[model samples]
Target: MSKRRQPSPSHPTTHHGDPERSFEPYKKAVILGLRWSNDDLDLVKPQAALLETFRIQCGFETASLVIPSTSSEEALNAISQTILELRQKYDMDRECTCHMATLFVIHYIGHGVSETEWEFDICGTRRPDAVRIPWSSIYIGMKSDVLILIDTSYSGNFLQPCHSLQRILQNNDHHAEYLFSTGNEISDQNGPTYDKNNNFTTRLTDLLYSVSPTPVTVAQLHEALCTQANDPSTKLRYTPQYMDCYKPSIIIQHVEKNDYIWKIENTTRKAQIPTGRALISVCILGNTVHGQVKEWQASLSTMDSDVTIEGVFNLQGYSLCLLSMPISLWNSFLHPGYNS
Candidate 1:
């Protein structure tokens, strides 16, 4: 939630606070590796293994799916099914008190051809002969955090343009982060030696492994990758690009250690009013709470004397409340219960 600046050379990656303190890891991690041809399995297998190992080491149950040499239709079907399965898994995990946040990582390495729409060359045939699939064909319904890494040529085209306002406010529940190998340019998938060993995948996995013990968030990884790409000594050919909305930028942990940590932090640290105002969105079902606006305002005002509800308006199911506050009371609202 800090203001953006140029990527810091010194702060390539961030560290986890209090190593002695144990915290809940991601509820589950599902990795999807897709390749247009079987030949690309050489890169996919090891990349998937690295991701699985990294997630597992961070105290998460990991599942990996690597699909090779399939038709675009079949690939889309498989991806859809995987996402459906994840949605089901999340629903089941919700029954348990401990498990809440879910994370999915998708890595695609293959031929990319752009025309009317950005397409993946599933069969690796050039142009008209290619069995192409549009990047946005599959539906991603899960509200959990998604990290997608695309290593094909023109991979940056895979990311849908997001509004700057939405990127800053981050009001949406669904969160997705992206890391693309190239920005509208051809990615060096096969590398100069044609080994696929010295490209984005290798560099990414190396960063992940190196920033261990301390968890590395998507933003941190992106920053480090950008730094590496900009460094002339690294001799990187393609520039990697990442996009993320800056709400609560996801840490590796799905849940904090305990309620006591929040209590201690709140009591000890003085909340700085970063913006002096906050807009809170709450969803209420069945219009039951529509009549309780004043009561709600009264209840919130008790938390801090300077805290006052400026306005409350209902848009569809969401109630948007504008609050004038002297300090950052937003963190106080984000407890374990908010995850549900």
Candidate 2:
């Protein structure tokens, strides 16, 4: 028998509205997951997860400014403008409706200013704070609804004046949502649970795959984050905060819960595609199942067992067969996969 292709696990997705509905929210989104500050600060897992989530789960066309690599001020500014401009381009390119479903997300996986005042990444010999860009400057330019996720460990004191989401949104006319990694004290957000990234992002990525399997709204995400923060099962707690959102109900796309996941690679290296082959585990009955995929596809069944799976194989390996529609329909009789 040949080696079974084992993709990564099944990630989560959210439904901003009903996926079955006529009109959907968050069709267009712009995301910037950067390690663009100091050389000592390079974030891996969170950035990778965010990129994939928005593309596969959120289902929004995305533009990633930089990952792990440092970005110049000019480049950062261009990215900010690109956010507003991308929406215009998305609507113009597609002849959808009078209004297009769009969302803007600014997710920082690395450092934010100091352990005190809030700030983003930086470069050059200038003082860290000098090169740092205030949160207000960049986010203020946002054209559409926005969600900001700060996975870095910074003091909550800097945010004292703007403690509540209601206060944060009250000052900014455009709706904004905020989620921080910790409340105050020292944060354990930097722990490595995935390959190179921290524990929080890896957990978050899995949460999207498990919590909601369709386009999700900001409120739904907040709930899931809160559960994880206070989850008894988890030793690592992350504080999730949000309020006064213009459309907390607006959709944010992500990975599906039931996907026959096929990870593009197998490596654990940061900023590189895996070994470029998907891996999925399976159990074959006999040689009879090998003659044609259809046979294995047909003989699929299930048994009750205690197992934790990143992605489930209902009828054995499933993504390849489903990739080509004719095979999918030809094997429509195949059983469905499940999550543990």
The local distance difference test score of each candidate is 0.48, 0.43
Query: For candidate 2, lDDT tens digit of each residue in 59-128?
Result: 5455655522234456457556765576566542443221553456666654333332333333322234
Compose the digit string of candidate 1's lDDT tens values, residues 213-276. Answer: 4544554555566657666667666556545533333444322225523111221222111122
Which regions of candidate 2 deviate over 4 angstroms? 1-27, 37-39, 67-78, 84-88, 92-99, 114-130, 139-143, 156-174, 183-199, 253-340
List candidate 1 segments past 4 Å from native.
1-24, 37-42, 66-70, 90-99, 117-128, 155-175, 183-195, 253-340
Top model by TM-score, which number? 1
Best by lDDT: 1
Against the true structure, what is each candidate's TM-score? 0.54, 0.51
Q: RMSD for each model, in Å, please?
A: 13.6, 17.4
